[model samples]
Target: MGDSNATMVTEFILVGMSNYPRAQMVMFVVFLIFYMATLFGNTLLIVLIILTPVLHTPMYFFLCNLSFLDMFYTTCSIPQLLVNCFFRRPTISYTRCLTEMYVGLFLGITECFLLAVMAYDRFAAICNPLRYNVIMSWKVCFQLAAMSWAGAFVLTLIPSQFQPTQFCGHNIINHFTCEIQALLKLACSDTRKMEMVLMINSVIDLAVPFSFILVTYGRIGQAVLRMHSAKGRGKAFSTCGSHLVVVSIFYGSAISMYLRPQGKTFSDHDKFVSLFYGVVTPMLNPLIYSLRNKDVKGAFWRLLGKKMSE
Candidate 1:
């Protein structure tokens, strides 16, 4: 019986942005541009971090980790999506779906925890600069980052284990890739417990980390307010502002879509919002941090200049 279940899936079709027959090409072109921007922006950030010694601080190190994650996360979904958008039949093998799910899970989980780590980094930088180095030491930062990646998969594996094949009923997934919730919705078996697990995951994913960010920022706001110099205030805001934007973008969509009750039919409006969490936020992270940040911009220019010469 178990063997029979295991053999049931040799392939699966991804029903996503490309499935729309009427305007698939237009959607493809739009996503193509977004995809290109995401790739170019994130890659540039990574190169900037590697090439610039000035960016060798705990802050940029975290940003670098974020850049790699954002890059890989999008790569897991976007190009495959681009390919399918153009192709007549956008079929994905069962093995490929599994692979995609795993990679996406790892990166998604990593980003969630990494964001929390970033909050702690901010807390250290602002609230305890004297001990920032000791607290966010090399060993500690990497450990936290590693756990984020590992933990996400650790949690994601729980769902995969119990989840019966939802694809048997409706093979077409309405969003990009086999999203966790969307995939779960396809299951034929009773999913009351599954929905509960998903809620817990979503709440933990959003609430705990966001709570940390909110608290850190609360402290940061206090610290900023005490600075009497307009110049000082500007500087403080400048640093934390990008992170604030990222937190807002990443968390807002997540809370709205995932935190609510588990619904049988997901709204198209919600699908669009999910893009901010999955696709748009990843693209924007590098841009917001790199463009606004002095060290990152300097690193970018240095790296680009060196690359051009070489």
Candidate 2:
């Protein structure tokens, strides 16, 4: 019986990105630099936010959480990717693969909720400026953040507890990282129910938050339009521009990855899309926030000047 064929797999061979043997070293160097930059950029942002009293507000508080998440998010996949780039036949133990998949999924879903909360912060700041402080107080901010993290962790745990029976004897993953969809391909058992579960999970974790962000931004747009002064509009736009850009990139890649028709063969296109969110996005986030944010730039200089004086 097919059930008997589905024995436990001890390890999995990861096919990674390129089949060209000569490209390995080049890929390794590129990804290594990306990993280092991701670490440095996110860590620097977190430290700067903490040291500068100017950034102690709710917006920066969420940004700090975002920076922290970015650090861990990339760590869940990038280091393993770098290592795989060097090995001709890269492999991972079953437990490690599942751990990576679970962590990555948790962080990714948490980010979705966090982005939605950030949009609400923007909405409050722009549409209800008179009570922005009262609305996004420290306690409320903490609760929103806590809920996002706790919800994502709990949701991922439910699925992890009921792993696909099809994967029992399977051991080959076509991607560098232990992506959930990639791992799903190894399952030999019927996966219709599992796929349906994943689809419902995606609807909850991805679609709902994305819709929330859109609605919040719709209110923000209305508020911005009602402002008579061009200066006021510009100020409001500047405040939210970085977050909007980040949301566009993240949600765009995520939707492309998860919203596709299921049961089709996973392709290199999917691998590259995963690469964008898993590796490149984290590295780009700090740069996007810091470059566009004058407050962050000022805080960076202030911190630098104080260090120099010391």
Using lDDT as the measure, the top candidate is 2
For model 1, which pairs clash?
11-94, 166-186
Compared with the true structure, model 2 gives a TM-score of 0.96
**Model 1 misplaced stretches (Cα beyond 4 Å):** 1-10, 87-89, 166-168, 305-310
> Candidate 2 — worst ten consecutive residues by lDDT sum?
161-170
**Per-residue lDDT over 148-248 for candidate 2, one digit per residue giving the tens place of the 0 to 100 score:** 99999988987775577556666877787889998888888777776777778888988899998888888899889999999999978887888888888
The positional error of residue 102 in candidate 1, measured at the CA in angstroms, is 3.4
Instruction: Kindly list the per-residue Cα lDDT of model 1 for residues 1-310, writing each as its tens digit.
Output: 2232323555656666655777778878887888788889888887777777777878888888898888888889888887877755578886787788767866776788888888788878877878989999999988887888778878887766666654443556666676767766665656777778777887777788988889889998998788778987787788889888998888888788777876786557767887887789987888898777877777767766887999
| Alpha-carbon local distance difference test for all models | 0.78, 0.86
Which residue pairs collide in model 2, if any?
166-187, 166-188, 166-189
Question: What range of 10 consecutive residues in model 1 has the weakest lDDT sum?
Answer: 1-10
lDDT of residue 84 for candidate 2: 84
